[model samples]
Target: MGIKESDIKQDAACTPGLSNFFLKDHPDENKWADCVHCGMCLESCPTYELTSQEQHSPRGRVHLIKSVAEGKITVNEQFMDPVFACLDCRACTTACPAGVDVGGLIEEARGQIRQAIPLTGLKGMVSKFFLKGLFPHQNRLNSLGSILRFYQKSGMQKVVRKTKLIKIMPQHLVDMEAIMPEVNKPVRKKYKNQNVIKSKGKTRNEVSFLTGCVMDVMFSDINEATINVLTRNGNDVIIPNKQTCCGALHVHAGDRETGRKLAKQNIEAFNDSDKVIVNAAGCGYALKEYPELFREDPEWHEKAEKFAAKVEDISKYLYDTGYEKPKTELNTRITYHDACHLAHGQGVRQEPRDILLDIPGVEMVHMPNSDRCCGSAGIYNITNPEMASAVLDSKMENVPEDVDMISMGNPGCMLQMAMGVQKHGRNQKIVHTIQLLDWAYQKEDGKEGL
Candidate 1:
């Protein structure tokens, strides 16, 4: 369902948090005031570049947040329209030399609005039905992913793409319909409860794994490979079943209560573990950020800090472990797309690249502006198709010709990049970094292993 201006504008009494959506959490008196409005982000903003509309630009959105925060305006349906229009791509941040965290500011503002205004119509219906209903519940997401896999496997996707039937559907639906990946596995065969994939030699590290929601559903194999690679290199892998959603989708969407609830759950789950490992960049960024989410809760704030301290990106952990390079080299030409969370969010710029470099027979071509987002930010592609496609197009333009593969750490990015490749009528395989390692180690035909 789409959010109607009428529904948002009704003179409904606003809750404290709901009345002003951009004020409370993560409040930085100076940080909020740092937007100099230099307009430097305008050129780099995907939405602004695509639409050339002031309402869609970063500066415009920031102005809206400021206005809403100062009570200069009531955040009725039309008032929040610009805020909702933001993709949270973080491209604006990348472009902002002042280093204002637009992503965080916009997210907090959205949360405030969600609290104050009751979502109605199409947008509200979808959020309640999907995010609150389907995603948070792992089992349901698994089922939905399975159903989607069938569509991909049964060539329903191909039929839809060929007929362009979804073009008649909602724009968001058409985009989601266009950007599905080739699902290979339904579940990670191992890595379940008490199932430890121990390292071969003396274990150098003991780590807990977050077998993510969408990850467990759609691309379980990658998670499994991550486990195998970790163990083969001599590290004990632990999958803590208690770890729930990293509260990324929830937090990003402005559903803070549920996000905080899940945040507390994940924090307690990882508290006992020495090091918490996450394969998904988005999840990694969120998992390491529990402290900021629960800052207001004096009770859980300390726990949040401790949990945040132990979180590590899977690539960073693997790189630090000195995993030996696979000896057999396939001589494949590949490029890397840095997930925004891993790069800009955590300053994890080198670890993933270093891991890719360590692999044998892999020619790593550094794409121009590799650090820029591919525009698959969680729900951004679904909500903002035109800008997402614009960013994808910009991303694909940087891909070196003759590249056989493009690898990334985030699933959202992989799907978005794959869609970009398809739309351009080109054939380029997209895989996780671990996929390359997994295939390298397999003893099957034409197998390449150290």
Candidate 2:
């Protein structure tokens, strides 16, 4: 269940002075060289805020990672607990004056940890099934979507709920199920026959879209909305058939080998496109970080860097390239929640807000600490339910009850915030930012009888 002794010896010979991390993708030393133990990041971290423990703080985690490199610690359960407990939200990096890449270090450290102590038993089985077997295959994900569609459409879901059969699972999962969005046909399948969805008017830009594995399956409506907004705004959208999962989830789960494999596939898939647009914050962030996965390989590393340069989040793309403002008005009061990857990770704080404000009659209410993590660091809610719930509860306190909707850029944040809304008995609707813009455009078209 661990790395072989021979493999460890080889890694040691290659990376001399390294004691615990016997892997090619060990945490980058340069990422943490700027850390002065400033304690500035302590206030930004969610775990530190909740636990009030130094070990849970950003500075503490950096120290621990440095300790592992210096032969002061080993990759034991004690070390694993704190590292895995982190939300990997990247808020701390925003707060750090030295700009330490804590999220990158955590991901790389996780890559090392999984090699040293591989998961076994039930956890291992589930991780392998989802991360390896399910995510990378588009056909498999589409099949899962079909199954989910049947479960939700058939009377089985209702019967199970009414019989209290769902209570057999844990409470957090039940909570997630309670607020689960209805599954629809993914946009990839919907537009499969058409290679290029041309613009309504004169073509302004040609961009390829990444219809993500989870994003397409779980929240395909948003994906469809994204295509509509783009086409309506004069961008010819391209959906590359060969594009696979962005590997954010795999990397987050410490499966760096699979992460690199997936990265290579996407880099090749979108090689010809001038712009690669992503609607999901996590997927966009992961796409931009493809270069990190190929640091050791120079040729692929250069390709990854070129690929990463073209990857842009949808909101930023629209804002930067000049999206048309909707003419019609649909009066709705909404507050914006910053998806951790969108706000802190990508520094996309203002672009989405700017997009929201451009829609006529949309009143923007401000949420305090809107950039705080909603505990949906990929599958963190499923893995660490208790902490995720506590973090969600803390996040809900800042949401304005007067708003009609909670708008954000990421699908994971939408689900997590939806659970928060349901749990707290609030009635605010959770929506992607692009959906609002699309709705406004549709309303305008409807009014003009288009």
Whole-model Cα lDDT per candidate? Answer: 0.75, 0.91
lDDT of each residue in 17-78, candidate 1, tens digit only: 23333335623334457888999999877677778988788888877766655545666666
lDDT of 1 at 179: 57
- Pairs with backbone N, CA or C atoms under 3 Å apart (clashes), candidate 2: none
Q: Which pairs clash inside model 1?
A: 1-122, 1-123, 2-122, 2-123, 18-115, 18-116, 21-112, 21-113, 327-450, 328-449
Per-candidate TM-scores read 0.87, 0.97
lDDT of 2 at 269: 95
Give one digit per residue, the lDDT tens place, for model 2 in 1-450: 223444444564356445667658878889989999989999899999999998899999999998888777777677788899999999999999999999999999888888777899999999999999999999999999999899999988999899999999989899998998999999999999998999989999999999999899999989999999999889999999999999999999999999999999999999899999999999999999999999889999999999999999999999999999988887999999999999988899999998999888999999999999999999999999999999999999999999999999999999999999999999999999999998898888784311
Instruction: Report model 1's TM-score to 2 decimal places.
Output: 0.87
Model 1 error, position 93 (Å)? 3.4
In TM-score terms, candidate 2 sits at 0.97
